[model samples]
Target chain A: MRLLIFLARRLGYSIFVLLGLSILVFLIARVMPGDPARMAMGPRAPEWVVERFRTEMHLDKPLYVQYYYWLRDALQGKFGLSIYTRRDVSQDIGEFFPATMELALFAGIIMGVFGIVLGVVSARYANSWIDNSVRVITYMGVVTPAYVFAILFLLLFGYVLNLLPTTGRLSPGVPAPPTRTGLVTLDSLLAGNFTAFFDALKHLIMPGIALALGGLSQEARITRASITENLQRDFIALERSQAIPERVIMSKYLLKLSLIPTVSILGLDFASLLGNAFLVEMIFNWPGMSRYGIHAMLTKDLNAIVAVIMIFGVIFITVNIIVDLVVSWLDPRIRLGAERAK
Target chain B: MAEALLEIRELHIGFEVYGGTLKVLNGVDLMVREGEKVGLVGETGCGKTTTAKSTLRILPMPPARISRGEILFRGADILKMGPKEIRRVQGQGISMIFQDPTAALNPVFTIGEQLMDAIRYSNSQEALGRREIRARAIQALKDVALPDPERILECYPIQLSGGMRQRVCIAMAIATEAELLIADEPTTSLDVTIQAQVLRLLGNLVQEKEASTILITHSLGIVREWTDRVYVMYAGGMVEAAKTREIFARPLHPYTQLLMRAVPKLTGEGIAEGIPGRIPDYLNPPPGCRFHPRCPYAMPICAQERPPFFPRGEDHQVACFLYKG
Candidate 1:
């Protein structure tokens, strides 16, 4: 009962936070020099064309009017039309958002599992060759720029090795079949077209691996450090003296204790995965939010840009709230007094 | 004797330091009866804890090496037991409460979860169903005299006071009714009032369970109040052993006498005079008797050769050159 209330309170706070952040980001993106009216007008457009464009985009309205109108329309699921594509902003997001979400989900799983396993193994064999080797790899992953790694992966896997697809979500010749679920991989599998599913998997491999690589190292290092510290604690020693099986100690005690910090980091990493996907999308020419967002920015599509930013904001805030709830659950001490009071 | 519940024979625990093998426990021998309360007393660095860890086979590996020892629990050498056998014995035959209660319970776990885990570890089959486990947990909490066991079950360790946490630890230790309970300075971390409460609680629980306990502490006062028998360790060796009252009333070894004098009494007017000189460095202890350098009645022979246990009275032994002849 208390948990439900706590979650409800957190979710309410997150919505307000995301709403506020979206407004701020919308204003900042607008203030960045380029006039959406002029950008939409193009080089050969006349004064009247620019004026017609401003009226159509609602740029002629006051700043406060524009924000209020945008917020109201956004609530109603009308994000307005994209000035660049001359299409509804919602349509653009609907078309591309799921692909980004699927990629992020896959990367999150890979990073979370691999990172925790490596961390446990490294901590268990601390100061040994295995520990040193993991540390070295983690350092490399953290220090190397994401774009550099992405380009390197593209060169090695996409260009030179030719083992994976270089561009798009599926093969060029394949007609993208029917979109039942919007997610290429799942929809392909649902269609029972193994060949199409395989092609989608190949296309997904490079980008997912590139994004996961950065997070995996950090997660592994954090888990290793946390577990190592936990291992030195008195409770761990007491547990050992109790003659609990090593497996029980690792899985039940150490892993559970270590996971408190790991879970929080994983939540933040999942959110960051969305941000990182932009670069990955660009490198692979993947038709996802990053590509759409870039086009919106270049063409000064105010409604599309605001809509995309708001969606990202919502995702980030929602993830953070989930992380907070998970942390509280994992560590009962946090809610002890509160439950008693209730 | 029908067979001691726990027997440590010629146990030698040491660690490999940069210099050489630093012996922590040198040929230490002790035994506990099935339901006896044994007080293992020593100053810091006297290897009392190392001896306790050796019995549980929980000593850190590599640097901490048990050079020679046979830790017999119910006539079986625990050191020779495999991992699985050892685990079965742990929490079933022997359980331990550590010095710091805050550090002893996992911070992430609630007092209830930790207690449940310990209970499950001891009797997993019986603790199978959640309802049964919850009932047992409540009973365990009640046994420790915790208020509102139901509410406390939902509370984390951090929310509880130090005294409450220690009680939770004690409750978990006794939950299984293990044959032996090793409490290493369990009350040292609490305040005087709480310490007394914990000490009394431990005594009551030990009696209730009819279990033997190895209470390791440096305070002779605790020895007088809690233990049935006392073993005084000086510089990695047992200097004296006797019934608690007898040892306190007529301490034979100089080290034991000095330790007894060091205990501050509320009835006394003057400040307590602590023993002089620090514990000898274990890296390269003095030859002969490790205590010879500090012994007031040190003889030439005492400085050259270690003294063996000399019989003093019924169930009394002293290791000192003065008692040798």
Candidate 2:
């Protein structure tokens, strides 16, 4: 019951945040020296046609009036027509959102698991050759962007080794399973198409890893530092004196306590994956929402731009709420204190 | 006196620092008898805590290395025990209560979780069921006089007051049924009003359980009131050891004498005088006696060689040239 209240409070705050984000994007898209209608119609189009397109788009109205109309339609799930695709902005997002979600979800898992495992290893063997090597690797991981890895993996795997599939969500001839959730891997699995699932998973590997590298490095570094710090804590001594095995102390006491800080940063890292996915998606031809959002931005597709921004805002806030809930679950002080605060 | 439960003979521990090793413990000797409360009293940095930690073999090794010594528990040398054997001795043979209750109990885990883990691991060979462990935990909490055993078990360490936390720590240390307990300044961080209560609780628990304890502290008053025998440490060495009453009545070592004088009297008579000069830098400690530079009764021979334990009376020994006879 207290959890429900906490979630409800978080959801309420999220709505306000998204609402502010919508307003900011709405005004910026207009004020940033571009007429969406003219850009959509392209150069050499007659002046009258541009004028008519502008009037039809409600672009000639006052900025507040335009925002109100856009918001009203948006609340009803109509974000007008995208200037780039000439499709409903909402429909475009719906079609593209699932692909990005799949990649982010896949990459997020990789980042979380491998990051922690590596971090534990690094911290356990601190000051040794293994720790030094991990330090060097993580340093390189942090400095290099996701797209660089994407290109490098493509060049090496796609061109030379040809070990993994480097393009799209699945092999072209395999045929997509029914678009139940639109995440090819999940949909294929749900449909019991093992072959399709395997193929989709294979396609996901390279892009997923490339996208995960940066966030994974950050996670490992944070986890290593936090665990190393926790090692010196007195509870560790108490655990040691109890004759608790080193394994139990490392996992139950040290890892659990150290994970709080690492988990705190995870929401931002995972959220940033969506923003960072634009280049990775484009390079891999993944048909993710970030690619669509990029096209929308290039053409100044006002409704599409605002819609994409709003969706990102929603995902970011939602991820934060989930992270907060996980943190509360890990720590009883936060769980009980949250109730007290209420 | 009962047979010795633990004995540390000529223990030398050093820390590898930037330039040189810090010789923290130099030929220190201590013995805790079966079912006897022994107070290891010394000021900070005097290696009392290091000695206690060494008994459990839990001191961080990279920085701290035992250069020389044998720590025997039940006639088995602890320093020679393998990892598996040492683990068996920990908690099952000897458990430790740390200085700060708040820091000793993990912040994230519940009182039940931490305590249950300790009990479960210590008795792993028994294959005890979950219900048995829970029952034992609740009983342990109850033994410590906590208000509600069930509720306290569910609460985190942060929820409890310092005294309560210390009580919980005592409960954890004693729950393993270890014969010997090493409490390193257990009440030092607690409130003054609560200190006596916790100490009394510890005393009662030790008596009730027929368990021996090595209480490490800087307070002579605690030692005088609580312990059977006292080993007064000075600059990483055992300056003197005798019956508690005898030590207060007649402090043999000059450092011990100064430590006794440093305690403020309740009558408001003379001011408490702390010993002059600081503990010598361990990196290059004084040659003959670590405490010689500060000894009021320092002699030429005191600086020439380290003094061995000289018997002054039955069950009393002091390391000072003045007692060379």
User: Which 10-residue span in candidate 2 chain A carries the lowest summed lDDT?
Assistant: A333-342
Predicted candidate 1 versus true structure: per-residue lDDT over B1-325, tens digit per residue: 4349999888888899888989888889888998899999998889988888777778777779988879999989998998777876786888888889999988887777777777777752343577776888899889889999999898778888999999998888888778999999999989888998889888988888899999999888788888989999988889899999899889999998888788778999789988787788888888888998888889999978889899898899999989876
Given candidate 1, what's the lDDT at residue A99?
A: 86
Interface C-alpha root-mean-square deviation, candidates in order: 1.9, 1.1
Residues A164-267, candidate 1, lDDT per residue (tens digit)? 88888888888675888788889888888888888888888888888888888899999999998888788887777665667888888788889888888887
Interface RMSD, prediction 1 = 1.9
Task: Say which docking band candidate 2 falls in.
Answer: medium
Q: Candidate 1 — which residues are off by over 4 angstroms?
A: A124-128, A241-243, A337-342, B1-3, B16-22, B108-142, B147-159, B281-288, B292-304
- Clash number for every model? 0, 0
- Give lDDT for model 2: 0.91
DockQ of each: 0.58, 0.77
TM agreement with the true structure for every prediction: 0.90, 0.96
Q: Which lDDT tens digits does candidate 2 get at residues A1-342?
A: 878888888989888998899999999988988778889998989999999999999999999999999889988989899888888887888899999999999999999999988898999999999999999999999899999999999999988999999889889799889999989999999999999999999999999999999999999999999999988888898899898889889878887889998898999999878878999999999988877888888889898889999988888998899999989888878887877776
Candidate 2 regions with alpha-carbon error over 4 angstroms: B269-271
